[model samples]
Target chain A: MIQKEYEKNEKTVTVSVVNFNPVWGDKAANLQKIKTMVISASQEGSNIIAFPELALSGYECGDEARRDHKPCSMHEEAAETIPGSSTAEVAKLTKELGVYVLFGIPERDEKNPKVRYISVAVIGPEGILGSYRKIHLAPPPTFTEEACFKPGNDLPVFETKYGRIGVQICADFWVYPELSRILCLKGARLIINCAACMVGQTGPEFIAQITGCRGTENFIYAASASLAGKERTLSYYGRSTIAGRAFPSFKQIFAQGGDREEIVSATLSLEKGQPPFDQLSLEKERIRSFELCANELKKLAESR
Target chain B: MIQKEYEKNEKTVTVSVVNFNPVWGDKAANLQKIKTMVISASQEGSNIIAFPELALSGYECGDEARRDHKPCSMHEEAAETIPGSSTAEVAKLTKELGVYVLFGIPERDEKNPKVRYISVAVIGPEGILGSYRKIHLAPPPTFTEEACFKPGNDLPVFETKYGRIGVQICADFWVYPELSRILCLKGARLIINCAACMVGQTGPEFIAQITGCRGTENFIYAASASLAGKERTLSYYGRSTIAGRAFPSFKQIFAQGGDREEIVSATLSLEKGQPPFDQLSLEKERIRSFELCANELKKLAESR
Candidate 1:
């Protein structure tokens, strides 16, 4: 694994994600907002671009989603299946402009009749790749996700000309280490978290650090895009972030545009992965010896 | 756990540990030194006190331990069993004096016949309650722990009037989630780590922070004592530190004196435990949730 250190700089992929605070019941306004973002990301040379959860329908579709979580409702007639209308339009742009795209949409699960809510990522490389549904719904008492959404079971990691990738919808990243760790074990070094990060939080720094901490722990690169701006039922914090283990600290590449919402981009490298363990880098292996010592103590305690 | 809420002040336990920079062949000098420190901890009102690993024999016995890893040889005749001579000596002052003591010793495993280096804690309700051995060993190429030690296996927690306590020998804490988490799970609130943390050939602040970082991860109180003074082999930074999950930041209650040696003490309240995870006061929960949201992005990178 210790390949002779290369003299050249590590090659990186520049990816952009939009953190647009979508307006509830305002499909045209949100579409215009997303269009501007997609255009900016394209101009910025982002090979691939993504948006927050429910970016197309907006996160505040609370009761509206319960009525009929369909894209065709409320003027979003263009929002259809992964390969239906939305992908068709975005795919046409991909061929025209030669840029990859993944975004959020009101997903209808073909497998289960009862499951329906916000599904994300209209994957496309040349045309359309596939879809990823939001898993681990935040039920009532926490949020109303369980009532409106079916928890996605399949965790898919994407591989394009760019890099190995994994995608997840909001709140799926909480304590379910298996979701992302499985992707890492599957050799997917890049995991994208599509989040509608809520507004009015505390310790932006610590919240931001989790990306880097997990990256260091699991040995991978992770990027998260969150919804930015205030909607009706919820206000989205557009402070999206990305982290790689190589860096000492996680960098916040995207800040919710103070006023004008914009796309944020950063280059993630694959070469500088660090072994999370092997913490014993010094001359004195205290933790190792302590283990022996603790074992002795445990035996004594049990006997007593 | 919410009992700490109504209290006017927080109860903190400061377990003082003595660090030894042992002379390669000088066990008598080291034992005499420990005798003095034990007497001082009781005088200073330290509710509990500890010593570094293999404090009596000095950590640099090397091949001499191959012959006999005892405290005394020939004229001196030192090494003793768990409740043997040294334990009796240590308990004499502690039993009546109202201080709990944990010190390192060379344990003779009667069962295996193979003499392994043991880190034992001779705790006293007012004296020696029991003992613990060093479970995890620090072997070669990794560090210098393999020079004269064998590993121990087992995890144990001790119960006393002070609290249900768990003991970890230096390196053991790093490997055994079962050691730390299980202790916490099984109701051991206080975790005492005894190590003769030698001042290796590295910067002191860097090592201190590394130790602090480990303490922060496993949410429990940690009182570590390292050998102090320039005892020939290595320099003991003498900065004996004590900390817990609540106080992630390492606080040195006592440090080694410049030329001579001294004992430091702090009164710790066994009652001042953190609030239960479920009833995590509003302000605390907000920080936790905010951190949860931020770390959510990192979720997909690493797996359990």
Candidate 2:
């Protein structure tokens, strides 16, 4: 295990979203590309930098039935263990830059090296803290996640000096908002989503719209990084975004173009504070009020 | 009861959202204004037209403690019983136009005329269909609804010739995605939202964003009508919108301007269809997959 070192000076953390398309099934090249981004993001003063889903081996792997598909040839061959090779290199970079990095990778199950799981890993200067598996698997034929990988079962919130961070893979972030709500209930102040969804197929406007609500409704900071350009037969939607509470009232705070590979960054406040509109607060008291409202409705329903 | 008549012609329903500014606490004037808008919506072939929260009496009502306040002077005077003078007139018009209308009105509780509930009533050629009381109440100072109106108890889905419909008031639509989910589970094919949220306070972008998600996630059509212009200290954000599942995809189909009075209309297909991305489907099979994923996470949590 390597020692991890983080900047002890700041409470305000600048988070960066790296939106870039990777060469399908190429691990060495993807890692090399991300290393350069980490250096650039660090130079730009980002305390935490995040990348799109499956950034290590790309995201064009076909479903279980199509495992032998062209792009996925690299999935099994390139699958790496946590401390294997990618994180070791990422860990060194984080230590040197004093920045934390979270990126997606296709993990090879330890007991059975042939088995792979869609996963995201967090690495600091010291070493790899841990990883979160993609809980929600996209069904075929839009996303073949379930076809090739075993779905992840945990919704882990990583604790840091700045705030508690919760992560969700691409499709997991959509449909089931319960994932985000539960994360917030568990004390996560910031939610990060890593995705490699197709571009023109699912418009960036739609992604931005949903991403914004997740942040505002939960009264937490949300940052998403998506793959840009093409990933095999699919074209990725780039517009990576970072949004905050709508109570204090703000617009599209940080967003990237749908057609481009770019890094979007913003400084987020993680301190527990009251919203300008008390009605939008995510505090326990506010949650209690909502419960009371629910109870009142229950009584009314019974009476009716 | 007067005889009612409606055009029994088509399965395709054209929904209209009436976005307008209401005179504070003036029910008669507001009714007159809506009458004109309903005629226009009918002319555009809309079978169903929706109006903003308290469209008949305005939404600037202060809490019970602040009833003596000037804006709320009409609460006692303006409160009317359902199927009262207003609905009687509205029903006549619905029959004449051959259309269904959903609008907000402050209802004088039948058992106790002194008490009122923030309610939305549905009227067709057959007269009053039913009503939904706002299940969730916004707390002060964003809104003092809880201080005045009792929270509603039922999530009723009204069955019509075209499709099943669900109603949610302003604040009820936000915070709880479960409200929409339950309506969908109960077979609502269309969800209507009536809102009078403040302009600069709750950004139009936020409202529009959340409204779109409610429709897409539920695989149902969603329409929102919000009050425009200034009422007392609050200026309503009036971007009435109509959204549906992008069929084979997801996005907001039609939306109106934020600071204007207008009717936004869209003809939607209510037939069960697959999402643009098959993985995005909300059908029972897909729902079951989500349950399985959730169960897996639960097991993982227990192990940890």
Candidate 3:
């Protein structure tokens, strides 16, 4: 396996987010585009490169199938298994480039071929690292994921050479704050959101707002890669962002993409030392309050 | 009790937030200032008015005693019982004005005199409606609440003439997102944050960022009333704000105060109809995910 040499002098990782626009339901074409972007980003010295949610099959592929009154939706028709063709292709590319890559796909369950999930696969030079299925499926009149996709149960953090990283899909990052907090408590130093934010329904500003808060509140680095351009009736607002604290108390938007296809990268320092006195105290208090918060959440779940 | 007549012509309720400056450890003088503001706000036709956290006894009263190396801190010396003199005074003012009022105080536990909590009291025309003791305490190095204050155990929602309202203190609203979620689930339409945001440690923008998220995410109205001006060595950044969705998908800052003493008010319509299809689906998904989220939180707390 070919491994790219990272600088041993500095504890920094350069992460890149690709604001991609995929041809609807065209897996082969999308994979070729992804391969080119991944190589370009790798050549740019990015340790980790990420793509938008459903970058392989496009976000509105299922909607098109549903609208056409097809017996099987495009999501089912185009769904790939974890170690299947698409992932193996990306895995091969990563092995050659010697960089970690993350991109979204519709994963077909091996046993139950009918069941599918909105998932992001993380691949390293060694091969398929892991995949995080989108847990919070977007529901209802605006966008319908629940009609076709099943929600994932576990919140898993992937071990990486850069750091322990956690991946979350679009709505999961925007709506639920607890998911990120849980990821933070589980030792995720950097969180990546694979998103496909639609225009009108949810804008880029809202994405930046919640994304920045998640980063600052948990005191962790966060990056989001989004799908730009249009997919059938849905037009995506791609303002992919990387947010972290520049100073200890202030959150800074390190890099942000515009409405068009582009790449945004930021080098984040992973050095650890004793936290400032205020931060230490705040962290201690956060841990202390977790039990109470957990109990309340349990009660809320039970009541529901 | 003289009840203020509310207009039944419309479904709107005017809520006021007082950006206050309190004299350190001077409860009597502060109460007088509060009374004056309450009357002024009531005259301006506000159904509810809120004051900053620890408005009565001042935010840095304990720090003063700590600095002086006194045996008993001002927080201990000046702490009042919930049904104590202060609540009675506020009750009288609210009863006369026939309006609802919320203000923070250091509550001395009736059972245990040594125990004190950073708490907000909600008083109505009838009397002292209820009080929400701050569940999350600010820890050391920035500001020390854990040094003298005990964290509250309960998250309570009080029913008022306008609607059901919930109260949270400074750190509780800023740090813990689940606390507001629990309150929202328990039927709180309006969440009020009583805050003492310090100048250097936390600023106005950070307060606004989290406050807006809490409102927009829950699809509920949120307001923060904060302590302004200086308190000994600490200076408070007072950008008190009220936030809610102006449009269905857009969260708007309805009203915001400056860095000095002021009262900001906004009229919100509380008419409940069937939620939009998008909102309905989102709420359904949120409820469905609660079980999985609670389990994760439980595991996280256990790991610690």
Candidate 4:
């Protein structure tokens, strides 16, 4: 196993993105798959590894093809509570490998087990750091994401050895640019997105374009992990990627191509005042920009 | 000239993006070049045409190579007032061809001619509709945009026979995505971006990515015209492009390659409720998303 030591105050961390296909409603099988992938990524010297959305139980939501889509009630059977058995299992692996892992799961509400959220958990060497519920659910008529999961409310930025980081679910990150902006404003230097995205008319190219824009616009490092292969109702596009902000110049340093079930890794130097990021005062500029459009945006919200 | 008839109720408008080299500090020569390009674009059946930032005087800012960068004071000599001789000349052409045009210029203040703004003007057949000043200035250490021109204040959306439109100058569009979001929310079906961007490590690919995002995110058509060829201090990547928003599936209907001087046109069907654009409650969703990040965004602004 390769274990590269980080220099003092340098704050360099290796991140890995895993693209794997999960069998729908198969929690046991998916957990096993994640265990193997996490160990392998850790062995490859990755300090952090991310899995696709609903990785634990697979993306069982119905798409256009499945007319008589199974209701959210059916999928609730696969939901697990945070720090439950599945997280416990991953926690053991994180402890052994000394690596941080972020993976998606169908989360059951503590007070109401019937309520579920498409959620992602952050696991560190010590234990579960935190979790993010998927906000900005997928639009209806085509897919039934709103029918299956309850939306997340809070935007959380977790403290890590490398830097302050944030998590966003697939559609939440794809639907609009606000989630990323909020996370970055909350002091997130890097954002992790977990998705089980399907290939649409534009194909995987659309996702790739969105990923690049998210990183560039927010001036933050972004690591996105997506699923590959066919599931029950839809086929997933496997193009997990990680992009970093290049300094002195405003261009994105993106990881090349990987459109299949594979692990992609890149090292990030957590130094201050880099290009793109340093070019503008992040929070200040975002606030000003947001303020400029505050009235219009408010009107837009009311109309919706 | 090729004048394709528009179908009843179908708002299909053709847009042209021009990519050309501008002669630094030469208003007359640049104006002549624009006249030729506009006629050519009109002949090709384009109802609207867009030119690069500072196309009238070229991007004459200093880079590392240019040891003695000219002051914005020197360039102010080239600045002209709106509806001045140059815009008047373009207005005559627009009236003759029955086409709407947008192009970059160093704008002189009417009250204080000494005050200049990095601006782009929108001209219809009748006369000048309005203009947008560069709101987000380039960082001084890299480009001396701040020292040269005063920033613009208001965001104006123009109503035309084609549709509602908005304009943003180079760095303004590149810096803050809020400008595009606000314009789209304010009923701008199409946004015009005029840029005199320099070639960077990512080359034309970076600009292409940003263009796609600006269009897709707002669910609006976006056309970006950038300067091509070499200037005194920097070499520009002339990859002017016009991207259409595909309905039902948020895929960006992008126009092909642009690394030379040419007019690329695409037909936009003014159909309501298309993929992507038609998918969600745009204004409402934007309002909610903006509200979700309002406090955080405000904090960011205050921090700045």
* CAPRI grade of model 3: acceptable
- Candidate 1 deviant stretches above 4 angstroms: A1-10, A15-19, A25-32, A47-50, A60-84, A87-106, A117-135, A168-171, A196-202, A236-238, A247-264, A272-304, B1-304
lDDT of 3 at A286: 60
Candidate that would win on TM-score: 4
DockQ of each: 0.08, 0.29, 0.39, 0.47
Tens digits of per-residue lDDT, candidate 1, A26-138, equal 65666666667777787888877888787777765455555544322442332355666656767777776566677777666556444465677555546787888876565
Candidate 4 lDDT by residue in tens digits, A138-226: 66666677777788877888877776789998767865677787787677778888987776734576666777778877777888898
A1-304, model 3: which lDDT tens digit per residue? 0011222323788999988988998889999999999889888899889998999998885544355433237688889889899999999999998888999999988888888989999998889987999987655555567677888888998877876789999878876777777787676778999999878765467767777777777777889999998876688888888986555454667888888988889888766532432244544556556656657666766866
Steric collisions counted per model = 42, 8, 0, 12
Task: Tell the DockQ for candidate 3.
Answer: 0.39
Q: Report per-prediction Cα RMSD to one decimal.
A: 9.6, 6.0, 4.8, 4.7
> Model 2: per-residue lDDT, tens digit, B95-171?
99889999999888888886788899899977889788887666665566666777776788787777678899876
lDDT of 4 by residue, B1-304 (tens): 0012112233678988788788887889999999999998899898999998888988775342124443554466788889788999999999999999999888899999878888888899878987788777765556677667777767888878876788988756765777777787677878888987677733577777778778877767888888888876678888787775685456564674467777777887775546543456665667677677776666655765
Per-candidate TM vs. native? 0.57, 0.86, 0.90, 0.91
Report lDDT (CA) for all predictions. 0.55, 0.73, 0.79, 0.76
Query: Model 3 clash pairs?
Result: none
lDDT of 2 by residue, A184-246 (tens): 665667788988767545666766777777776666778888888877777877888888674
As a TM-score, model 3 comes out at 0.90
- In candidate 2, which residue pairs get closer than 3 Å at backbone N, Cα or C atoms, i.e. clash? A3-A126, A4-A125, A4-A126, A64-A147, A64-A148, B248-B275, B248-B276, B249-B276
Model 1 chain A: weakest 10-residue lDDT segment is: A1-10
Residue range B1-304, candidate 1, lDDT tens digits: 3233325422555566654455544556766666677677766666677777767665544434334443223112334556666677767767777667787777655554345456675667566677777766654332444445566655667766656777877655533333454454444656776665445432233223323323333344556666667654455655555654432221222233222244545455555543322222322322233233224323533442
True contacts kept of each: 0.01, 0.28, 0.31, 0.46
